[model samples]
Target: MADASPKHDVFQAIADPTRRQLLKLLVDKEMAVTVISGHFPMSRTAVSKHLRILSDAGLVRERKVGRETRYSLQPEPLLELKRWLSYYERFWENKLNVLKHLVEIDSETGTDRTGPNRLKDDQTPD
Candidate 1:
C-alpha cells in the first residue's frame, strides 16, 4: 500500500535544491510567478510545480492581486525543521567537545593519536 502521509512535508519540500533557491528568492519580498520564473532557466510551469509543492508543505503562501498571483514565504513551518536540526547541532557540539578534550590530552602527553608521525615516532637518528 502507498504511504498515507503527505508527500510534501516541509522536510521533503525543502529537500529539492530548486525549492530551496525559490525560498531564498522569496525571502526578501513577495513576488509574482512571472518575476520568479525569470530568475530560473526553467519554464514558468516547472517553477509553478515547485511552488505547488512548497504550498502543500505550508512553506509558501499565495495571494491574488488584480490579475496576478503573488507568492511569499511562510516561515512558521520551518520552525519545526529548525527544532529538529537544533537537536543534531547539540549532538555534534558535544561530540566536538569530546574530540577537543581528547586532542588536548594527546597534546599534553606528547603522543600522537593519529598513528606514527614522521618527525616524532617514525624519525630515525642520522
Candidate 2:
C-alpha cells in the first residue's frame, strides 16, 4: 500500500513540469539562477518560480555567496517518490504477468481474444 500521508509540499512541487526540469538541472551540479536559466527558453523569472517550488519541496537548496544565491540538489525527498513508485511496481508486475500468461495461452491455442472473452450479447450485464 502507498504511504497514506498528509499533504506534503514536496509532492505537489514535483507534479509540475517546470519544477521537474528545474530539479533535473540541479541534479547534475549546483548552479546559480543565471546558469540554470540559460538552459530554458523561458524568462529567468519563470525559471525562478520553478526553483521556488523545488525549494519549498526540500528538493533544492539555495545558498548565499556574496550577491549570488547558488542552488544545489536535495535528494532526500526524492527517495519518497522512489518508494511510492516502488509500491505500484509490484502491483503492475503482477497484473502484467497475468496478462502475459493469458496472451501466451491464446497464442498456443491459436485463439485471439483481445477484448472481452465473452460476447456482450452472450451475457447480461451485472
- How does each model score on TM-score? 0.74, 0.71
Model 1: CA > 4 A from native: 1-7, 102-126
lDDT of 2 by residue, 1-126 (tens): 975543347779888887888888788889999999999999999988888878877888899889988999998988888888998899779767766766677779877565667324333223
C-alpha lDDT of residue 94 in model 1: 71
Number of residue pairs clashing in candidate 1, backbone atoms closer than 3 angstroms, sequence gap of 3 or more or interchain:
0
Rate residue 50 of model 1 by lDDT. Answer: 97
lDDT of 1 by residue, 50-76 (tens): 999999898999999999989999999
lDDT values, one for every candidate: 0.88, 0.80
Give me candidate 2's TM-score against the actual structure.
0.71
Please tell me which predicted candidate would have the highest lDDT against the true structure: 1
